[model samples]
Target chain A: MKSLDFFVYLFIMAGVTYLIRVLPFVIFKGKITNTFVKSFLFYVPYAVLGAMTFPAILFSTGNYAASAAGLAVACVLAFREKSLLTVAIFACAAALIVNLIAMAIQ
Target chain B: MKYFKKGLHDGIPIALGYVSVSFTFGLQAAGYGMYWWQAVLISLTNLTSAGQFAGLDIMVRGAGFWIEMACAQLTINLRYSLMSLSLSQKADKSLRGVHRWITGFGITDEIFAVAMGSNKDVSRHYMYGLILLPIIGWTLGTLLGAVAGQVLPEVIRNSLGIAIYGMFLAIIIPPSKKNHAVLKVVIIAALMSCVFKWLPLLSNVSSGFVIIICTVAAAAVGAVFFPVKEDSQ
Candidate 1:
């Protein structure tokens, strides 16, 4: 990509992403009254993160079994409310072992 | 100053997680023949994992792929609009437009989760502190990973790929454990994502739009089924 073209794409990417976030802060100055709208916004984070995570995490590793192992470890750790780093490290370790086993099997 | 200290303290784990994932991203950029500086610029300007990965493909494909770059970016980053919308409810009105502009630009998935989950209403300085370390970790990781190109073993890199998803799980699961409604919404959204991935027509849609549709629909269902007390939300 030409230097100018690359910079243009970066501008668009940055501009679009920033606009998406800033619009809400600019628009909703008053208290939202509608129950459903309130409820919808309340649930948005969970829904968004969930939709982003599930099915996606399962396919993250090269092997299905390894990915599943990682996910299972994460679930159990997070269920126990372990700290984020602990959950991440153990999950990665679990996946690494499972991936090695899968490799051995292959 | 207190919240800035608190924000710095809270951001540590998130910064740690970003290092691994952005390291992977940086390695991929190097694999695409990006200079270390270019990869650093991408991480600095974009700050989005999914959007940057998609944009990097467009960069490598050709200059004519700018349309693909634009579409991929908007679709993937659209979730931030929803995240910021929710966060707008929690943020203090004292936050000026400039602070919103600064904070708004850095609202990644993990940052939004931590901010929204904070005990106090988010403040300007708090956001500055909260987003600070993660941005540094993200930019530094890319620079290191790009410069250290092809150094790590393939096995270790693949293992690190699981770390970010684990971080995502860590964010969602604790809340779900205490709140049954959150658990339900999470389950529904995940199931719907599976449907979107598998079902004929919907499966054809890009992953980004699939996320948007599934999130809105699932949250709507939660809104109907488990409406929070207006005051509580």
Candidate 2:
């Protein structure tokens, strides 16, 4: 795509994201008193990340098996309270190994 | 200066994590044949993973869907609004005026977490220090990944695809391990996402909207059924 064309989309992404992040901080000076709103905000990040990760991760690699291996490794490490970098590196390493083994088998 | 130095100290892990995750994003952007600089620009401007990836898809394929792209970004990034609000309460007098806007611009998930974890009030200087390395790490990682992606072996490039999702799992999983409410929310959201992916009629929903629906539904369920205690923070 042309640089100009791509910038249009980039602008939209950045503009909207910055708006979301900035508006609340600038407008809401005091604490949010609503309980439901607060709880929803509290839980929404986990929900969004969870929805984005799964099913998507399963299809991220060359094949399902390799991706599954990656997912398994990631889940275990994450559940064990591993650092984000460690979980990420180990997951990719696991997927690569599975892909390499599959290639050898073929 | 002490607060600034402390912020930098606390930001080290987040910076390291962003490098690895954004490396995957850069690789993917390269796989899409983006110019290395263009990928870096996206990282520099947005500083988000899921939103950028989703936006890239629309930019490449669905050229005329700017509104869809905007909605997708808003939905995917809506949590930042919450994070920003939460941080606003912690803001000190130094966080007023244009400083608030600048500070808000840097409120990524990890940044917000580190800022909130601080027992002291958040200052503009502390935010500046906290945001500096991660932004640098994210953009540098993207530049390197995009450039290397052009010459790297296909297998390695493809295998790196899972790294971003791995980071996502890392972010959400540990919290879930500690809180049953969070665990249920994660499971419900994941299951809803799967249903939207596989079920006959729902399969036709656009990926962006699917995420929007799953997030709202799952989060609403969490709020209504398991409202967090007022003092829980």
Mark the regions of model 1 whose C-alpha exceeds 4 Å error after superposition: A103-106, B65-68
TM-score of chain A in every predicted structure? 0.89, 0.82
User: Ten residues in a row with the worst lDDT in model 1 chain B?
Assistant: B61-70
Which ten contiguous residues of candidate 2 chain A have the minimum total lDDT? A41-50
Candidate 2 lDDT over residue span A1-106, tens digit each:
7667788888888999999999989998777779898887767777777788768999888789999999999999988978767887899899999999988899
What is the per-residue lDDT of model 2 for residues B93-179, given as tens digits with 9 covering 90 to 100?
Answer: 888879888878899867886676566889988998899888888898788788875565767766877877877787887777778
Q: Give the CA lDDT, 0 to 100, for residue B201 in model 1.
A: 88
Q: Report how closely model 1 matches the true complex, as a DockQ value.
A: 0.72
Write model 1 residue lDDT over A1-106, tens digit each, in one string: 6788778877877777778878886677677778998899888888888998888888777778888999999999999988878898899999999988877787
- Model 2, residue A46: what's the lDDT? 77
Worst 10 residues of 2 chain B by lDDT: B149-158
